[model samples]
Target: MSLILKDLTVSAGKRPLLEIPELVLPAAGFVGIIGPNGAGKSTLLKALAGVVSHGGTKTLDGAWPDAGRIAFLPQDFTVSAAMSVADCVLLGRREHLGWRVTGHDRAEVRRVLSMLDLTPLSDARMDRLSGGQQQRVLLAQRLLRDPRLLILDEPTSALDLHHQLEVLSLLKTLSGGMLVIAALHDLTLAGRFAEQLVLIEGGRVHATDSPERILTGGTLDPVYAIRCEVFRDRDSNPVVVAHPAQGARAGSLER
Candidate 1:
């Protein structure tokens, strides 16, 4: 399974959000989409997921994939306070279950809950869990569908450092089976986890390559407009350290 986009352009109202001349995503592995705010990173994922209208051709494995083959978890997910964690996660199985929840559905819900370490909170109200736990529950909900492509928009934004690592580790493990595309703000984390990286800016793809190739001073500084240093960690992976803009640094010094 592979996803290919040709001359893809997405518009919202009257403004274009994403424009990609050509891009290809391999079937199985984690692909990170990184960029500054308003860079259309999330919009690109939405286009691939078919959640938004776009002009161009998007194909899976040289042909159009099924409509529900892709599962998307948006950046801002509102958990209904009245629903229990188990019930919320169970929602993912709705397409398979039609209108009634069956015994198999309950078993699958338990399975996903256990997989996400949410079994203990299965009966808890959605409002009672912490931000990280809520995110996990939402993830479990998406996993219930066993999608071929999983599109996540800043899925770890509200998580603590520990939970962030936990979620990323889980994603890394699952990357072999699903085409995982995530919009990530943490450049270092993205470098460490993603097999491929796509940098977006001004509604276009600025660069696409391995993390070490794309997360460099030359590629990033031009887009971010700030000086940055790229280095390798002990394991020999790229890490980016950005410097404040000269004007911002001067302003701070005057204080």
Candidate 2:
């Protein structure tokens, strides 16, 4: 489903954390939000998911089929110590059940657990899982809803390189008819997986375009405060190589 953010602003206590004049998220495929720390990337996602209060309109297209609607996975995921993995994932079906979970809901929970490679951990307590495994389990919970719009905040933070690729690949495969928006810190992985990229800085949208178009040195250098070299791979897609900021040149010796 398409998401339109018009004049969105978010405040935390006395400070404004996010301010977006306008943004249009595509109806399908993966979109990456990239920026430095405290750039309001996570805040943007939370605002769009209606988990936080913000000023502005976030509209999902009416023409688009709203099957399961929206699901959000935050960066810091926490579950009660007593809840099992299966039970946590089963919570995603709560909206459909209205009051109580049924046999059908349990079946869906099983399906999502298997789909996310969590079948083996179904009976395990969520507090006992590793960080990466916990992340996947939470994703499984979100997937149980079969949402049309999936918003994830820093989904790869706790994953190793191998698991990171695996999660991102799974996300790509799952984006066939859904919109997947993630706040990602790894620029290279973001470029590889995301069809489009949105760069934010100082609570403002600096640029939004295809990864090949927005990950360029000209756009990233100032925003990130680092020198970056942009090059093309064998496929002619953009690859960014970052370096430290340039230092002042040494004084020249007298002739």
Candidate 3:
């Protein structure tokens, strides 16, 4: 489940979106990709998932896994308007089924639906669900596949604080036997949950290490263009508190 990348580069037309000279991510842990907007965070995930065309090698354990072994949940996920929640989640089992779904696949679908508390909505149409509900349904769909490499982009964008914690907690538990990588906007949540953090800046990997080692103000101030402080909780985990950039604060003082 380990991932190794060498000379990886992604571009859109003439503009390069991501470049990583080398990176090795260990298997079986939650790795958080954190950066400001347009920092190529999403592109990095897409490259690893092979969602975008890129240069260089992205291999798992010295070879590539089949597409079915890797599951990707993009930031903007959409489904057909006519599909029910149960049918949508059941689709993840398509890779294993041959022309028809068996009882095992149906059981897995039911298990994940219950895990995500979607049993009540099993018959509901996906298009009519709330944003949070839809997000959970999509998550259940991905989880049912039991992918070896799970890639998620802004997975909790529409979830409330409660569901956010619930989903992260679930991923952490699920990562015991797989690699779960996500692009997260909340620095505090990323610091709190991810065992390893990959800091992307200007389409390059600025840092990759334990969250405690990289969440400091010195490491983040320039990338985010803000003045910030990093503290530790009772468990010694990093906690970030940010303020406006120094230049912005100075301008306000002058006024």
- State which candidate has the highest lDDT: 3
Clashes of 2: 0
Estimate, for each residue in 1-255, the C-alpha lDDT of model 3 and write its tens digit: 578999999998999888899999986689999999999999998888887899999887778878888889999976648789999998887767788778888888999999888899999999899988999999998888788999999999999999999999989888888989999999989988898999999999999999877887778888888877777778777778888896654211100
Candidate 1, residues 1-255: lDDT per residue as tens digits?
A: 577889999988888888899998887899999999999998998888888889999887778657667779998887757799999998887777767788989999999888777899999999877777899999999989888888999999988888788888888898888888999999989999999999999999999999978877778777887667777888887778888666542211100
Per-candidate Cα lDDT values, in order, are: 0.86, 0.84, 0.87
| Residue 148, candidate 1: alpha-carbon lDDT | 83
Clashing pairs in 3: none
* Model 1 lDDT at residue 36: 95
| lDDT comparison, 2 vs 3, better candidate | 3
Q: How many residue pairs collide in each prediction?
A: 0, 0, 0
Query: Model 3: runs farther than 4 Å from truth?
Result: 247-255
Q: Give the TM-score comparing model 2 with the true structure, all chains together.
A: 0.88
Q: Worst lDDT window (10 residues) for model 1?
A: 246-255
1 or 3, greater by TM-score: 3
TM-score of each: 0.92, 0.88, 0.93
